[model samples]
Target: MTSTAIPSAPRRSTFAQPIMAGLVTALVGYTSSFAVVLTGLRAVGATDAQAASGLFALTIALAICAVGLAWFTKRPITTAWSTPGAALLAGAAAVNFGWNEAVGAFIMTGVLIAATGAIPWLGRTLAAIPVPLAQAMLAGVLLKLCLAPFVALSTIPLHVAPVIVVWLLFLRFSPRWAVPAAMAAALGIAGFSMGRADAAGVMGQLLPSLEFTAPAFSLAAFTAITLPLFVVTMASQNVPGVAVLASFNYETPWRASMLATGLGSSAAAFLGGHAINLAAISAALAAGDEAGEDRSRRWIAAVSSGGFYILLGLASAAITALATASPEGLLEAAAGLALLATLGSSASSALSDPSSRMSSLVAFLIAGSGLSFAGIGGAFWALVAGLTLRLLIERKRH
Candidate 1:
């Protein structure tokens, strides 16, 4: 008897899985922390329009960087706006300089990032910085923002409680989407607050427009903004981003990644974006098994995510308008909830090393204090103090 050969099951399209992964990566990354970016830009002397422009510029620039890097390297390399750096900006004290000076600081930060890749000694110097202290500084920078959720709940429970509850539900069942869900709920409240007369005007301006500001350098802005932004982006975002990719058995092209992000940051600076760097948390979405079983094809996810980011960038005006118009404490509460996980992780890492615990604590306290001296912000001082204390302690021990 002859047995008929069985036909194999039809193969699924190879592109669909990775494309969906890319879409989720872009959606989650953009929705999660954009409020924080807007708040950070506004904190550093940006007007509402300039803040919106900054957000748009950052989205487009980083999206391009991600697309280029992934396409050229054939790796799932992703770039993102510096979320930790943005937190540093949001927590920064009032500087004596204006928006122009802040723009100069941003340019300087981009130059420094590029230098880190081109100059071996500079990257080494940044690498030599103790991890615990760096994390402590980040934790300190995030403290006020992380506390905002409780502050909002205490003051505006009627408007804020529902958002918090939704965040909690998602956090328990779907942690990755928690912040985005809360942000959506917060936007709903903000939309309800807007009058119909203003809705048409807001709708008409949904497409974003860039606002350029020429750089005006100042020592105060450099000390308060540039130094902290560079250090934070490198330590918290870029370094961790590379490590994350490595964990998935992919080697990122370091110099290329840095140059791409640095140039992107510089190009976007004129339009108010503070900085862009390698993505840490969101990088996994595009680089991991979720993208596809074939490691060779995962780069498609990164490239696709970049396309989605461009689409999202077009909606910046609408997002900024809604967030800025939200009831007092509402959007801030969403931002705070978004940062809570980072704060916890940073705080934990800062205190994990027994030998450096005190120094790390010092850094954390100073950063959280909002102190300013000689027109310099607390973040700068926190690093100095932590390093000095660590050095002195090491000397005594020896």
Candidate 2:
């Protein structure tokens, strides 16, 4: 009998690649964290500073996952806190009770997530779901975000249209430079507009200051914040996160990753933060070619991301200075453009599968529609739809 040969895995080049990726991921958080923080803070009625603290806490927690795993495995494993957690809280805060109650929801949700990690069934169940379906759902979930730049133009046509045009042209021509180039162009234009127009509340150098609010527990906040958040996270973020890891052929223990994230967020919540989880989207940046040429050292990039994020979390004031340093308009445009690729990729991939494609398509629509029930997010709705279709279709075939 002829012996079959097993393929040898590639060797990693250096730790520098993962280190740089980690740092860049942290650097992105410096400015971007404000968006999530503001939304979550307002949801719970925390002071702006408290919201910043929440973001700071989230960042610190994420760093812990990246660093902890790297130290243990000696392979850089990257992780991040939830960006969508802030988004989830924003709506939950607005519709639900007070901020203290929202914090209670945060704590409740984190505990549930941690518990979910401890159970082997959770991993098996989530794993049974098709990677393609999950990926598609994620892309669909972000469809609107991809279209945001263009749609945003209608709201402020005069100021933003030029950059949109330039960005569109660049995207049409260069393809690769589309996202970053659009980013630079948009920020440049927003800055120019802000300088000329001088929008008062949103402009000028804003200083970071400290403030505190006591947290109170409430069932309403917990239902709105905790339940919906966990579902969205499990479906939208972690499902796709695992898919991305699969794409890269980097296999870290899923249960271990979840446990780490849960513990990290559990600690972060006491200080004031929403949730922490593996880095799904940002991990792609470093784990992909953007981090470096050496493939095996991808974990190193994740480790780097964690360390730098911790530094940012520690120097909360410094993070604020740089973000508020730019014109708010610039921040908005820069953010929109910078995030476009992630949005587009998610939307595109969600539709990639042909079999049960409609099921996933329905999932995408439900999830991306931003419709909520019981304070749960669109991600849950999409998964529900996808699963429903999967079950019905399978049953009919039998």
lDDT of 2 by residue, 104-182 (tens): 7777767767777798786676567765566555555445444555666666666567767766887799755555555
How many clashes does each candidate structure show, in the order listed? 0, 11
Model 2 regions lying over 4 Å from their true place: 1-21, 28-47, 84-94, 128-145, 162-228, 235-250, 284-301, 314-339, 353-355, 370-386
Supply the TM-score for candidate 2: 0.71
Q: All candidates' TM-scores?
A: 0.97, 0.71
Kindly report which residue pairs in candidate 1 clash with one another: none
Identify the leading candidate in terms of TM-score: 1
> Candidate 1 overall Cα lDDT vs. reference?
0.92
